[model samples]
Target chain A: MAKENKEVLLQVQGLKQHFPIKGSRNVIRAVDGVSFDLYKGETLGLVGESGCGKSTTVRAIDQLYRPTAGNVLFEGVDLATLKQKPLIAARKNMQMVFQDPYGSLNPRMTVSQILSEPLQIYSQRKIINMTKEEISRRVDELMEIVGLSRFFKNRYPHEFSGGQKQRIGIGRALALNPKLLLLDEPVSALDVSIQAQVLNLLDDLQKEFDLTYLFIAHDLAVVEHISDRVAVMYLGIIAELSPANDLYVEPLHPYTQALLSAVPIPDPKIERTRERIVLEGDVPSPDTERHGCYFYDRCPKRMEKCKGSIPELKAVKGDHQVACFLYE
Target chain B: MENKTILEVKDLKTYFRTDAGIVKAVDGVSFRLDKGETLGLVGESGSGKSVTNMSIMKLIPMPPGKIVGGEVLLDGVDILKLNEKEMSRIRGNRISMIFQDPMTALNPYLRISTQLIETIRLHQGLDKAEARKKAIEMLKLVGIPAAERRIDAYPHQFSGGMRQRVMIAIALSCNPEILIADEPTTALDVTIQAQILDLIKDLSEKLETAVIMITHDLGVVAGMCDNVCVMYAGRIVERAPVDDLFESPKHPYTNGLIQSIPRLDEKGSGRLFSIDGQPPNVIDLPECCPFHPRCEKAMDVCTRKYPPVVSLEGKREVACWLYEENK
Candidate 1:
């Protein structure tokens, strides 16, 4: 957990992704001024409600959608400034596993073909040179690593169940031996039992490859389980960033507290007795320009200053940062 | 306070006639719902949790899907035997259902007023003015702000959570005795899900309506339901009180499911306990236990035949070979 010696694998500084509406002057700021440092071989969990820009943060970091502002420093190299060829070259070190496993995989292609597509593309582009046999061998290894049988390589994606399809997705992501993996709600679509399987597989794969992960998911329990550090986002901003235990055990931000309280504990004795902090109203649309806090409307501990100015994420305790006027 | 049994489902068998064979969607599923008590049906997809509730509502489509056997006893009357005309009177009047996706469940083109008023008028025999007044009241009851104005707006104007609130309003407008909410909070965010769940819990208690919450989330089941029914491949694998089910699950499948979920309260960095193998495909399923392939304590008898339901102490019921001796 020491930060002095650990390398920063990815440094996202003031990253912003904004989409403009057609025939309108308004822009929907999906990811606005988010900053974080993902340590090497560590899982940094990004959690929030839907439309809170959790997915957009990772997508923007992956350069799936070019950020409107700020820098994405992957291994000290600024991905935001990189040109098309250099960006593609840099992308070889980072791969993204999308949320929907069913939609991500091509229905027509066989499992082997799907897993090998990345390798073939990389080899064709001279990013990684490998013969057809080597690619096939790597696919087999990937299938094994992801706990899928090599015999199922000939089967199409449609033949696999949700969990199996997700395994295939994970196998495809690990095809090029990327140092960093951007998992965007990878296990959300699967069942609880299968979700655990994929989570364990991801944990093992990270250890096996020494991969740094920016795990994006809404399920807080899953995030707590896999992440070394957790970041709670709200309407394109990090409300709180702390160690997984600290964030869960002693959350500073009101939004974080409310979010944690909302997640029902599986134990009935605990769930029935616990006091929940249910926030009022829906998440405001991200389109309108906001000078004040994004969560001002629903924040239970809102003040006059909270309505006038946005709070900066500052350290209240050791390594525990919160964005609220109360902390100030 | 005495508990009154409101509905009793006996040996329900709902099947789908597919090209491959008959898919036993909800085979031999039975449970009892007491008045004002919340019951939970927890299972993964294709485990027939949703189908069981749909059969109770008589909403299953014909030709492909059919309720071949079983009786859905409401109060004292067997509703499965009721004709289409008779079932129509009972469908929305006495029993109501809210679906998973509020967006698709609601009619986009129709105004909220029209949808709410139509249901109220059809069931309660209220006139236009009274029904319109009652519709706004229903909307207000579900915590929709400015219900009078929002009632006139179309469904597209509302957010996902607000849309779900509207769905609840419509479902509970008639004050149905039994409310079946099928994954009501699945499509909602945690904050919004909390709001919806709180509203449902509060309103159900206020209206004295029994709720059958069908979801895959054990957390939701633990918090909301009085009794929990764990389903695995078209049959109830286990049934117990919520506390007992979580604390000491009898069925292997239920125990696996309870342990598999990463708990919010527990602090652990260890690898999650996951069940091996996938749920069996229900198409042309055999008479043997479907979960035996994934169960760790699977015996020779589990592969040969399905285990009979065994009633244990504390009113728990389990359909596994491990509990067969207690039968």
Candidate 2:
């Protein structure tokens, strides 16, 4: 697929999400300033470690948390400026799938009720009008779509395994046929074999429904496998953004290089001889204000200029963009 | 460096008597840990990797959970046969275990110094002053900055990575012969995980402490373990040298696990090869091969009976009908 040929489904322009401390004046710049474009029917992976604002990015885009600053252009309409009623209407096109399958689904409700709740609510709100029989039919279709047996519709969440519960969650997300799905570490909780199954199901679902996805995960390998393009986030900002293959093959940012090196390959032969870049300390607190680049203190390739000013994400190659002095 | 078996588990069976029926959590698991050698127990959730270790540690809650049969031989002494008092001496002094979540493992109310000193004092019979000094030293060894000053701080004061380091510090304070690390870095980030793994690798080599690493992540197993045991439905399905296991896996489950993970080195847009069906429930599990239903190359015999363990070349052993003829 050509890059320029695809239409932009969601455009996040200089998005910032900041939360102030209760008693203190200090603010946590969770998603300081992020900008990206989600193309139609494409999966854009947001990869980062914990507290890197990957989840916050998805939430801000989904309007779960109103952004502190900047615009979210969804289908050429500014979602950031929309009121509660209009925002609710805009959200019909987008839906979120959470990480923990055990916690996500309601244990009390059966699979049918769990899947139908979203449809019922959306229909009641006049987002989409559907008859009860049609709702029942759609629920059955969703079960088939996510590879769950329709016979298990009356079963409670506790009866289902972790993988089955995840399928139910996916089915519920697809109830209204949302154009975009915000997958926030959907398969992280699952076992390796089950993780593979879910990943493959997501791949098939995207193709079958023509749904766009903003996949957020800490696992680089999983993201690379699914994402068309990858964005590596660090301390609330994207350090590098490129085509999935290009980013993994030739990482531009030092953080991306270090992160890539840190992940141990499954093969013992490769893992034994491979040199890992083990970062010295933990990620710095997001609450602390910094004048320089977010990665300056921990960065191995830190320069004098990096401490004085922040580096803007700039394109260095055809599709690879990096926010580092080395690239500049 | 001659290889010597320090810990030998012989036909260990830990079962849980649930309302549904007897859940064979760790059913007849057997393996040997060489001195200073890192042995990886690789399995998914409820595959009995954790139960096997817990049973060895004698930490399983009885009544509901019971070690029905087994012999955990440590230096020719059957630790499983020992009384509660006798086992307590061997628990931390000889064989220390670290859990996945450090927060839950460490007492939040107690200061770092209290926990560290208590373990050191109990095992080494050291005084408070000497124990505190050794605690700081152990903390420093695990790469905790300002160990002397932070020794009084609570577990909540430190970050997740630092807290894990504290757990490691306490675990290794006694300089145990065998250290059982059960998913120590699973709760951490990739960068922090690398740091923790490197520390463990370096410390194990320095202290000559044998490590039994139990984890679901094959990447961790590949990096840390000299030998690997792939568990399935509370049984050791396959056992092999780390290199041979990844190079040429004999069991269908091991092969499926390796094929399933998206590789960091490999660049492919194609669909990942996923094993069909979920892991079997262990409660009242049939006598036949548990993984046969999900196995790609399951034979007719696999459904009728459990496959016998076949010894292959390079010290590898696999329990599968596909390799039964090789026996």
Highest DockQ among the candidates is held by which one?
Answer: 1
TM-scores for every predicted model? 0.99, 0.99
lDDT for position A37 in model 1: 91
lDDT of 2 by residue, B1-327 (tens): 769999999999999999999999999999999998999999999999999999999999998999999899999999988999999999898999999999999999999999999999998999999989999999999988899999999999999999999999999999899999999999999999999999999999999999999999999999999999999999999999999999988898999999999998999667999999999999988889999999888888888888888888889888888877742
Cα deviation in Å at residue A323, candidate 2?
A: 0.6
Query: What's the distance in Å from true for residue B151, model 1?
Result: 0.6
Predicted candidate 1 versus true structure: per-residue lDDT over A195-286, tens digit per residue: 99999999889888888899999999999999999999999999999999999999999999999999988999998898999888889999
Q: If chain B of candidate 2 is superposed on the true chain B, what is its TM-score?
A: 0.99
- lDDT tens digits, residue span B1-327, model 1: 359999999999999999989999999999999999999999999999999999998889998999999999999899999999999998778999999999999999999999999999999999999999999999999999999898999999999999999999999999899999999999999889999999999999999999999999999998999999999999999999999998999999999999999987889658999999999989988889999999999999989898999899998899999877742
Docking quality category of candidate 1 according to DockQ thresholds: high
Q: What lDDT would candidate 1 get against the real structure?
A: 0.93
Per-model TM-score of chain B: 0.98, 0.99
Off by over 4 Å in 2: A1-4
RMSD of each predicted structure:
1.1, 1.1
